[model samples]
Target chain A: MSSERGRGGKARNWLRLFSRKSPPTAPAKGKRDATPDAKEARAAREARRAQANAKKASRPAKTMLATPAADGRHRICVIGSSHMVAYKLAADETTIDPRLFVHFQGLAGREFAAIEADADGIFVDYEKLLLSPRHLRPMWDPLTDAIAYDAFDSFVVVGTLRTSHILKAFYEWRTTGHFSRAYIEAGVEMLIKRDPGVNLGQAIHQASGKPVVTLAAPLTAIAVDVGDQAAMDEAYRETKAAIEKGFHARGLTTVFQPDETVLDASSTKEIYARASQTLAGVEHEDEERAHMNAAFGKLVLPDILAAAGAQQAETGAPRLTSA
Target chain B: MKNPYQSLPERAFWRPSVSEVEPTAISDVYRPKFPVDKSMRVVTQGSCFSQHIGRQFVTRGYQWFEAETPFTHFPAQLSRAYNYGVFSFRTGNIYTPRLLLQWLRWACGRDEAPDEAWTNREGSVDPFRPAIEPDGFASDEEMLASRNGMIARMRESLPSIDLFIFTFGLTEAWENKESGVVYPMCPGTAGGTFDPDKHVFRNYTFLECHRDMTEAVEILRSFNPAMKILFTVSPVPLTATATGEHVLTANTRSKSLLRTLAATLSEEHDFVDYFPSFEFIIQPPFKAMFYDGNLRTVTKEGVAFVMSHFFKAHGAADETDGDDAPRRRTVTEAENDDLVCEEVMLEGAAAR
Candidate 1:
């Protein structure tokens, strides 16, 4: 707290940042950046420059994060299930808050870690984890790096309520051919009640000392289940509405479903759900029909942007006048 | 030994009605005139004291009818704060028999409330139940729509309400002179401006209570003839009285009047039943063991005692070993229950 300037102190910089992980005891006004990406990029750039200087002086680079800047574009962090892949794709495809840089980490939806309450803010240590694809290491590093400095302005969490699950249950006849409209609706309700998104958002907000935005898994039609899509459509819409309301109640933001994501009440357009090839023309992952391609990700980018805008609006809230 | 007194049942006298029996052992105070089981679509609306009945229904597995539930996604506590799904509907505490009748009349389309809403430094409040919304409604139009939604909910739920438990908390109320209707709280307590000329304090009489309650019952039965109404007088004494009498005397008079009216109504009709919750808290032998430090607010033990007898008579309490669980201990139940009373505000102002 002494200075927001250069600190010659070295060894305990990690401890200093770790101490910032304490619960934001009082949520003060104007304490956080309204927009984050640009600031994070600048922070990373500055961090590199400082690390180079530290190397020249034979001091540990960890000292760079010791002195903090009070205001700038935020350092945004995202971590969630497979749905995060689409979010990563969407952010890349779209123009985002110029001030913000998203340091996103992708974890399968089933993984549960009490991140926010942890003294060391790293929810998962990528170095310790063993995965089928080593490529995920790059994704995990940014989240740890962001938390080490207590650098997040906001956090986005995506989870099981994803539309891929919706498409699988309601959109495809192969999986839902025997299900009645009532049964399907009930299934959707069950998924919502059990959806980990809101709880994760709550935990992240509490632990990270940052505003949290929740993204319900996006909706895409399961092309296989053409038998009766009316039920699936109703389920999807109801689930989305429920998820949004739940998030709002907990004081978290929600990314809106992209427009034209659904072709009709019962189905997602084929083009959106088709296996999306990467820029190198390679398939992304398991050949799951429920996942949307990058084109669909482009459509969903606005929702994340909207959520970012909402977070800023609240932090810089205009004192509302009652009529 | 062969005297006439010996011929009477043990339940006929206080010595057996409560004394000589453990406080928790008291039972059969609520013998239903007809069958009422767990499946009954029960509706609960009354004083703050009646919240115990609503909370018990959930633990006991009865389908306590929630006609107007907030969107399912809302966190349970926040939903409760907005007064959604906390009761059978969001009528917020119907403290008087007259207010119940007023609500019944409006619900049945026999009457229409004035296009009235209240506003103050905080925000706009619903004319009937102001504190139901924390910040008050944003606009008079919003308040009106919310009120309409509540009435519509009553209209939909009334047909299925097999049992309606209403506990009267007060006989005193402030009346709108022009409208001739009583309000739950004095205007300025939670919202609106207090005016001496516009607001007149009225202590409702036994006759008015009888007429209003009977009319409310008739209106309810007309919609669904099978609906059985149970009346319980709140044990909590008058927090403060506007009648200019000492508060202790005011408590006695208010509770006695309500008790007599309920007893008379129950005696005259098979559908109407009165439960002696008033006596269980105030009378001797028990020695107000159920009350909190205030000597007015009933404690968890008192609510449990009343409920034990109530459910046992209806043949439900036996299943519950009647453990004194503190699940119902909440900010709303303990401290926030006072929000329902205008007199509490009077006490607050006097304290200041």
Candidate 2:
């Protein structure tokens, strides 16, 4: 039994010699007492952290979100030229929220209806209105008084129309040897007096209180094939330029330009042309012009709607208001 | 080795006796952790996906601005072309980071004023007419100074942007001949007719793309030092590839390189981050769930998925009645098969 145990122990020792072993351990050392400087340093670091915390706590919190107004109603207003009225008239009322009240101001009713009915008659009437001193007096008076007016949470205006009309009136008066600078100045004075108590720089301030936006004009959809189309295009361009000038002068923010190119004039023309082509076989050619039979509207509507939606999202205000 | 069942110690195969322990409370799962208090102002820009970020921000009550947009009722019908100044800026889509930065500067009033002559409107003086006519600015310096004033105004109006989101789209672009400016598409596709002399094709290398991206980011950062960046690679394949390589191969190569570069850059920079939008859309499990019938365009469902994932990941998921809840519906395998076949047919038609 002793000899067997001896053989087993020898085998165990041989196995141990070939096997891997852990590293040798170091001798244990005695703990040193805490130093005064170390304690002081740690205290200082803690105090600094505490100071930072206190400073942070004392700072005013920044607002990341806007709170909705307590009153449910979100006021909005629209102000623009005749085209604006036309576009707004075409708008689907159901899409708009009931909480918002939209007030359509600017050239509407008879003035707009006449223009829609006959463009030439409307121009002639406008010329007569401008040439006659009596017609101008009533127009300027209301505008001036309304400029100081309130009761609007948001204002949507056709910048081009306002700008173009005023500029054209001023230009024709100056060139035709009819109205003096003093008269023009008087008209401008009335406009300034009527100025919506808002400027472009003040837009953000106003928007923060209640949103205000100026929309650029929509491009004309007249076919370029006609000679009058070129003239109309030029007139449209002039109108657009005038609107931009007016917006700049008033310091109002405009979302877009009314140039035909920007409005997808090519696509619009294509639609009209295609409709005309399709209607060539039918008797209702005029009906084809009135209605967009093709999906052209869909293609353009998305972009338009997207922009409008973006505007609404950005502004975060009601589209209309009523007191 | 000698005997299969020698009288070895029982300890060799003995397992520890099991003891029953009481179940822990579920409280651990609901334990509160540190809350983030810092208010981060993030600005997002890029391809269509950027709009997703903006929409999410608005929906969740986060601060964001879509500069191109203005307040209006008929948002669906708003003209995007005009909003982006595509006609005047002559830059379509503004897909690339560099152009986006440039656009931001223009929108914010940092870039020099555009030439008044370029836009011939009544009442506004054509500032560039002299150059094209009898007399104008004596030199480019004079014209630039005039333009600089407009830029200054734009700069002043810009709000301090904090975060920038960039999405990489295509590697191909066309350069102009006279002004040497880059156009988004070759002239003929959208507005400009194809002219060999005026429009030149450019297929940017990965390094070139990286350099441009880096430059754009740096420039934007210069405007706002605190601006953090999030880069995403668009998974949408090119509508058409100008590169001679097979369209599919070219798109894959382009997207892969861009994704790699974006990841590499994000790793290198502290402020820069990469979002897994590309992965989420292109992954096998998602399996073209984000694509429309055309396979190229994103469907509303796909947009919703992306938006949901984004909101969930960002911790901005709507908690109020779970407004964005998943809807459940059962469809037979036959219906699924038909849908798939229809999609395939549509995609084939679109490709042709």
> Which candidate number would show the highest DockQ if scored against the true structure?
1
For residues A233-317, could you state the per-residue lDDT of candidate 2 as single tens digits? 4444544455446555554545543233232221134243234211112222553332232233222322333332323433453
Q: Give stretches of model 1 more than 4 Å off.
A: A1-78, A88-104, A110-113, A117-121, A124-147, A150-295, A298-323, B16-18, B27-30, B317-343
Backbone collisions counted per model: 13, 33
For model 2, the stretches where C-alpha displacement exceeds 4 angstroms are A1-323, B1-40, B68-76, B79-81, B84-92, B97-154, B157-159, B177-179, B319-352
C-alpha RMSD between model 1 and the true structure: 13.6
Q: Please give, for residues B158-208, the per-residue lDDT of candidate 2 as tens digits.
A: 336666666776677666666555554455443225679767878777787
Q: What root-mean-square deviation over C-alphas does model 2 reach?
A: 34.4
